[model samples]
Target: MIESWRWYGPFDKITLPEIAQTGATGIVTALHEIPYGEVWPSALVASRNGEIRAAGFDWVVVESLPIHERIKRGEGDLSELFANYRQSMANLAANGVKTICYNFMPLLDWTRTDLTAPVARGGSCLRFEAAKMAAFEIHMLGRAEAEADYTPEALQMAAIWFQKASETDRDALLHAIMSGLPGAFDRYDIAGLRQALKGYEGIGRADLRANYQRFLDEVVPAAEDLGMALCVHPDDPPRDILGLPRIVSSGADITWVLNAVDSPANGLTFCTGSLGANPTNDLPALARQFADRVHFAHLRNVRKDPDGSFEEAAHLEGDTDMAAVIAALLDEQKRTGRIIPFRPDHGHELLWDAEKGTHPGYPLIGRLRGLAELRGVIAGLRHRD
Candidate 1:
């Protein structure tokens, strides 16, 4: 693996020099300051790339180039939006970044009911509790079709849970669920959020996948021409929340993406943690099947609970067979003779590190432990080979 770290941008407390100390040579970053659906100017791209190089890291991958809601809805100025995305790919390419990781979930990029669930290891970590989520959907946000998404047992639990939420808890849950989006949850009021969710109103997974294919058809050519790989990120939480469709949550999803554009330029960011949230996702097996297209990876795990429940786990200790995941990744590298870019993603906030106020899981000590674990696995695999 070409071990890497995800850098949030210039304002991030975790500096690139600090990232270099972690031993990762590649930087997985994005032009977050730029607005969505607009072209990323070559100048802005060069500035960030130059900074990473100056700090002793390679601008190797982009964590994302967000697809606008307008394009997802196949609504307003979608042609122009897609064209801008294509041009953004071109700009990122001009700066020598080769891979782009993006997702297709509507409205929310990812959803978690509890941003600070107390973990067994002690410090607070992100979690998704079905009960809290249901309360948000039914009582707080009042999303239509909320009850139908759950089983009778979950609905019953949610009904009781909703009754007990303090007004503050309910509001907090709403903010957390709608926390991060294209413009970073800037439009999260119930009515607007509902409208955004409804924009996919009649749209199903199949419909969304088709739209994604069309979007790719418009831009993958640009990626190919620029010698860039577009690695689509899997859905975080990996489940349909609030009755919304999730197209990037499964092996089949990756297959669909590959079939959309049969080229090395079209690839996958095999995030074990995101896909592992679904008990059905066989991480090792999926890794083996999609190895060729996996140009980027997020190595993390989640310990799943009953009724849409889960909390982030240590990178090596989560429910995912992280050993097998790493083994597969290393095997892929040996087979291809090329190191794939990987970042130990979404770590728990830990002691001493909590005082810094870093981006969710981008803390130093937590990910240092994770990277060490993953590095050990990689070394073991190599020695055996």
Candidate 2:
């Protein structure tokens, strides 16, 4: 597997040179400064590649070529947006960058309720609390249909939780979900969220899936023509949020997309943390089943509760069977004869990183520990095989 690190361009707290010290040979990044619907110029891509090369690393993956909101909802001048996306793909291919990771989630990219949930080891991890999210949706954002999405008991709990929450807690919850953390693409407050939710008022699961299918139909061929792989990321929690439907959250959903496009260029970003949030998703089985289609991977673990809340766990210590999953990935690598680019996704804030202040789930020390652990697992699996 090709070990990689996600860098949020020049503004990231952890510089490219600092990342090099962790032994990651490849950089997974995007031109975050570029607006969503604009064409990514070939010159800009080359400049970014040059920066990475100068830092003694190769740019292996474009973590995202963001699908515009208009494209995701099937709204407003889609032909123009699709044209820009295709042009961006051509630019990346022209610059020798092949793998592109993106998501089709409507409002937010990935969300959490707590950015500093306490771990037993005295570090902090990102957490998603279902009731708190419900609280925000019901009492804060005042989504009229929010109650229908939650059970009576859950709704009651959320209301009570909202009543007891302090103003700081309320702000923190809002910031965690809507504002803070990397990859939100845009920030939102209560009014902004209410306005954003309005965009998906009539859109449901089936409609969202159809829109994504349409997107695939339009872009997959372009990606194939350029010999580039487009890997779609799964929903962060692998479920619906804020009354919006999540189309890419399950095996059936994945099957639908793969069959919808049916091209080698249309692929998956196998994120264990996201998929494993739902207990029904068998990590190792999914890895083996979609081995051929997985172009990039984000390997992290989460400890899930029965009530739909979860917190990031150490890479090897969560509900996910890391050993079995790694074995399956190794088998797939052998079968395909292609190096899979996998990164240690969403680590805790630990050691000096906790004090130094870093992106919510992207502290340097924590991820280094995760990468070292995953690397050891791969080494051991190869030795056994």
TM-score of each: 0.96, 0.97
Top lDDT: which candidate number?
2
Model 2: runs farther than 4 Å from truth?
179-185
User: Which is the leading candidate under TM-score?
Assistant: 2
Candidate 1: tens digits of C-alpha lDDT, residues 1-385: 7889888886578887788889988888888877788899999999999988989889888977988877777775577887889888888887788789988877677778777677775777878888777767887668757877777787777878888878787777776776545334245777877766767788788878778888889988888899989888899878787677888888887788899889998889899888999888899999989988899989998999877688889988889988888788788888879889898987888787788887665678788878888888888878888
Candidate 2 lDDT, 1-385, residue by residue in tens? 9999999886588999899999999999999888788999999999999999999988999988988887778887699899999999999999989999999888787899998899996889999988888899889988867787777777888989999999998998998986332453678878877887788889988888888988998999999889999999999988888888998888998998888988889999999999999889998999999989999999999999988889999999999999898888889889879989999999988878877666778999999999999999999989997
Which pairs clash in the backbone of model 1?
198-201
Model 2 residue 165 CA deviation in Å: 1.8
